[model samples]
Target: MAGVRQFDEDSAFEQALEVFRAKGYRATSMLDLAKSTGVQRGSLYNAYGDKEEIFSRVFERYADRFVADARVALNKAGLREALVEFFVFAIRSITQGSPARGCLSTKIAVEIASESPRQQELVKKMLDELEDVLVGVLQSPEARAQLVIPPRQAARIIVTMTRGIAVMERVYSDPKRLRQTASALIDTMVRPG
Candidate 1:
């Protein structure tokens, strides 16, 4: 094996993800990624091309996991529980570290606006996938009975509110407030008619 990687690729990507989440894409440099990942800069370049390439890889993994988690959270027994759990899942996601990093995809979407079309498209696609998952949950037989609006409209509302929660998590960093907000959203959005 002439060029087999000597370091842990998965661990490096996880560290790179943390760096990007903390500092955003443009603020994070190759050296930052290397130091965070414990990987040599030259080795990083050789193994993963450049900063953008590494970010792309990390973003893809994150996007997949995010959507999968959404589906799981939205599959709870009752509509209120499902939506509440989804928001709880989302709040937990953004509040992982000390000061809260917020949603990485949402942060990257705002951070890279007017920068890279490719990154913009990636973010958009992830959002659309999330919205679709919400729609599916809203349209489920258990959820449909309690819906006050069309499933698509409700899904969009959920998506927008989810993004807002991410931003507010950074601003307030209070899980209790976020949970209250989620409860209010569930009440307003899913009242029986």
Candidate 2:
């Protein structure tokens, strides 16, 4: 009889994501994923093809979760508060799983962005969507009333600051400082100019 899958697909994918995020695409091996997910090497190959393919799935999942989580900022009461919280959340998430891991998208974007077209497109699409989210919020009448720059420009600034925070998380694990940095950025943004 063919061996039945003892692993849940969703659970296996989640496990694989953690491994990819921690070790990265070029560093992770099929054995590593199988061992981590308890799925066995042959089975993993049969199901997921190779490390690149598996990491692709993980990358897409990460993108989905990121965009979804980022939308939470828009749901908050105030635009300035939302921008601050949004960046604080990004920094926190980047620093969340393991200090060594940093942010998966940022890691891949910096590491293999030039080499991999897929990675480049994914990073671009996700970031563009995130900035668009910020633009939507910043274009609000409330937000427009206080802005020194255009909404699109303001959104770019917010995204840039948050991306900086994500990069900064590599060396800094202090959530308080991250939050303060984000708060300071927002303070400067909303201040009259």
Best by lDDT: 1
Q: What is the C-alpha lDDT profile of model 2 across 43-161, one tens digit per residue? A: 88887778777788877888888888999856787777677678767876777754555788888888897898987998888889889988888899988988778899988988887
Tell me how far the alpha carbon of residue 159 in candidate 2 is from the true structure, in angstroms, after superposition: 1.6
lDDT of 1 by residue, 24-68 (tens): 999999999989999999999998888888999999889999999
**lDDT of every predicted structure (CA atoms):** 0.88, 0.81
Clashes of each: 0, 0
* Per-model TM against the reference: 0.93, 0.89
lDDT of 2 at 193: 32
Query: How far off is residue 78 in model 1, in Å?
Result: 0.9
Best by TM-score: 1
lDDT of 1 at 26: 93
Of candidate 2, the 10-residue stretch with the lowest lDDT total is 92-101
**Residue 193, candidate 2: C-alpha displacement in angstroms:** 12
